[model samples]
Target: MDATAPPPLPTRGPAGSPRGGQDDAAQLQLLSVLHYVMAGFTALFSLFPVIYLVLGIAVLSGAMPVDSSTASSPGEVQLMGWVFTGLGTVFFLAMLATAGLVGYAGRCLAREQRHTLCMVAAGVCCMFMPLGTILGVFTLVTLTRTSVRQRFAHGAALPPSTH
Candidate 1:
């Protein structure tokens, strides 16, 4: 209790014990691997937006023509179709890019790098996708913290290395 003594550092686990001194590293590694696998699945499913866009364009452009009885002249129909097709293509590419970026961010996390910037970028790209933005935002939030960042990078909850 000497006044000159520096304050004790906070303990992270059981009383008078350091963290990750046992099986924690292995558990963290497994979780990291699982997170990456889930991210891969997310990336694959995100492609649906792109597929929808292509199908929409095809239908609109008369490439996959609708019932003949419902349309007037093909020329007017074709012009209208092009507009919808173009819009669909734009949205499709946007969604695809979002998914790809998020997938890449997940890979970065699994590799144990500082993924905050990448996650933020992925989240930004996913703003247009319905659930994508929400998931990306969650990932970004979790990855931005100091402890979480360290845990991800090293597959353990140890303090960051000074070297």
Candidate 2:
């Protein structure tokens, strides 16, 4: 061994390669996946209100019975049914729209495009709590990195392989 020779460069791990670019890319990818999963859940839960509206209608129509002791008059039952239906429709549409936006943001994040839009979506995700909070924070942190910003600027679909 030559003492005067420069020390060998550190070997990069599979994920830590790409001049430290892969780490950010991987984090973004994970965040994107989380957004997608959250979107699916949002969409699924949005249907619950619709189902409630349907059941309400059925009860009002007498197809499903209500106990006589607790039952309101037909007019009152009809009004309640309408209210549920209206509220359910509004909630369903709103949640579906939210899910669509999040899903679109996830796709853009995975492609390393639309940085500002992804950041906005992530911020919105932060409002949802629990899973969204985790995903949103991670997304914000990863997307704010200098390297990640450069990757977006370069419009690269994926990080270059170090091999």
Candidate 3:
């Protein structure tokens, strides 16, 4: 119990060492890992649309027949195939692109760079439901913090602390 007990250190502690950023560092590391995992899941789900693509190809190739009861002519069947193909391709490609962005954002976070990219990725991730929403919300919250923003600005990895 001494008045000279060093005044409890500044809120930011030191110049190069973030003394107060330990929590932010840990949270960023965890979020980055989660982003990578989410990216993988998104990429995996993107393949589901390939089923539609394959079915479309089959219809277009004449391997699949159209029901006379449903379609008036062969032309209608071909058009249907095109619709499926186009929609499937669009969804698949879009999801894959999103997955890539999420993964890249995660890398940026880990490296403490590209704060804008990370924020953008988080917002995009929010479009997804449930899990993605959770991750996105958490990421958005973490990135909005003052200390975290400063860390991102520094663009330097926090040194591992030895207790």
Candidate 4:
């Protein structure tokens, strides 16, 4: 043996080549819970743009003017209202759909099924920044592990409610 050779990797915990089923199960459970949490937060944040919708409606109805001093013409106000409404509606729908997909991925992760959907959801989640990014990265890493993949492939994981 070389005198300066690095020590061998420990055969334990996640560092081990084949972490036992229990660790894999625990990790999947944790990831599932985090996915649900991120989904809830995403859904909650999705409501913020609703204020834009409300304001747009008010402007369209003439209750709110685009410019208080009337510098802008009615046509401009109408156009702005439509723009706001359209932007708000699109954002709300997109965010809500992402939240639903993430939640379903969490459910699938818990049950060890629909691995492709979970991977896709995790990839989508990477775009949310901060908390979602962290959760998504961790989920992607966990799901790609050999032992974890085996568990998912074999349908050995049970939902938290069942386990």
Candidate 5:
């Protein structure tokens, strides 16, 4: 090959080959799976606060017994109930929204479209900790790579093979 010739384009290899576009596709696949798992957890966990609020309201309304010493005045109890209800609703809604955004980003990443939007969504996921942190870091690293960016920008002529 001529010294000045550019490197040959990489071919899709057998599963687990360490090639440029293949690596980017694998990373995108991983990100999609992570986002899906996170979305399920977010939807499931969001219900917990709602359940707690309902139980608390029942206790405050005298449908459930409370320790006499720990009980507050009826007015105070009502106020606390209202506050918890509002906060729990906000938290539940926020979690659902985050889940939706992450899921959408995953779809975009898989299709190799809206690259910048996917990066921003991944950055937001980083704030969530644990799984989100892992996914976000991997996403940022993979998507920022020149080869990956080019793949996303120009669109892949063929979908990466799973096997």
Candidate 6:
């Protein structure tokens, strides 16, 4: 090569196509789509039991109109409705509590800003069924394994201790 020759520009792979950039963009798009889908699923999943409970209450109270026009014959339906409402209430409370625990774990995880409150909020939200348990478990796992939580807890990175 001539001493005066210009250096070669970095070429894109395979016919000058920017494969890495394209791959990154594709991954971002895929992840965005997944996030949306998961958000929708979580909203629906968390609210379903509550909805069932409310509906059950309405049904039992004769506020919801069923197929039966006879008011006196709402015995079996009322019983079932009450049962469903009771179960739903129990589950809703449980989900809420679980969410709270997970949130605590989250606060314990952040390094710079130790958002114990945020973690508490997260745990509170987790009280709701699949959301609380699933998210809580994930946050808990992340906090337990990483030095982030430990550092945050101590307000500084911990130095290795010699025995």
Q: Which model scores highest in lDDT?
A: 3
Compare the candidates by TM-score and give the number of the best one.
3
User: Scored by Cα lDDT, where does model 2 land?
Assistant: 0.82
> Model 6: which ten-residue window has the lowest total lDDT?
103-112
Q: Candidate 3: RMSD over Cα atoms?
A: 4.9
Q: Write the per-residue lDDT of candidate 2 for residues 49-163, one digit (tens) a residue.
A: 8886787677667787666666467667677767777777788898899899899999888889999999998988888888888888888988887778888898979656465
Residues 33-67 of candidate 4: C-alpha lDDT, one tens digit per residue: 98999899999999998999888888899888456
Instruction: Give the Å shift of residue 43 in candidate 6.
Output: 7.3
* Stretches of model 1 off by over 4 angstroms after superposition: 1-10, 13-75, 121-138, 148-163
lDDT for model 5, on a 0 to 1 scale? 0.78
| Candidate 6 TM-score to native | 0.43
Model 2 segments beyond 4 Å from truth? 1-17, 59-62, 65-74, 159-163
| Residue pairs in collision within model 5 | none
Task: List model 3 lDDT by residue over 10-32, tens digit each.
Answer: 46455336555777888999999
Please list the residue runs of candidate 3 whose C-alpha ends up more than 4 Å from where it truly belongs after superposition: 1-19, 158-163
Candidate 5 positional error at 93, Å: 0.9
Worst ten in a row by lDDT for model 2: 11-20
Q: On residues 1-163, what C-alpha lDDT tens digit does candidate 6 reach at each position?
A: 9999999998656522456434433433343343234444454555657987998899888788788765456687888798889999987776555434433333233222353543454444455467445554444444343343443454642234464
* lDDT, model 6: 0.52
In model 2, what is the error at residue 61, expressed in angstroms? Answer: 3.9
Question: Which residue runs of candidate 4 sit more than 4 Å off their true CA positions?
Answer: 1-19, 68-72, 159-163
- Per-model clash counts, in order, read 0, 0, 0, 0, 0, 15
What's the lDDT of the predicted structure labeled candidate 3?
0.90
lDDT values of the candidates?
Answer: 0.56, 0.82, 0.90, 0.85, 0.78, 0.52
Ranking by lDDT: 3, 4, 2, 5, 1, 6
Candidates by TM-score, descending order: 3, 4, 2, 5, 1, 6
Residues 111-130, candidate 5: write the lDDT tens digits: 88888888988898898778
Error of 1 at 21 (Å): 9.4
Higher-scoring candidate on lDDT, 4 or 5? 4
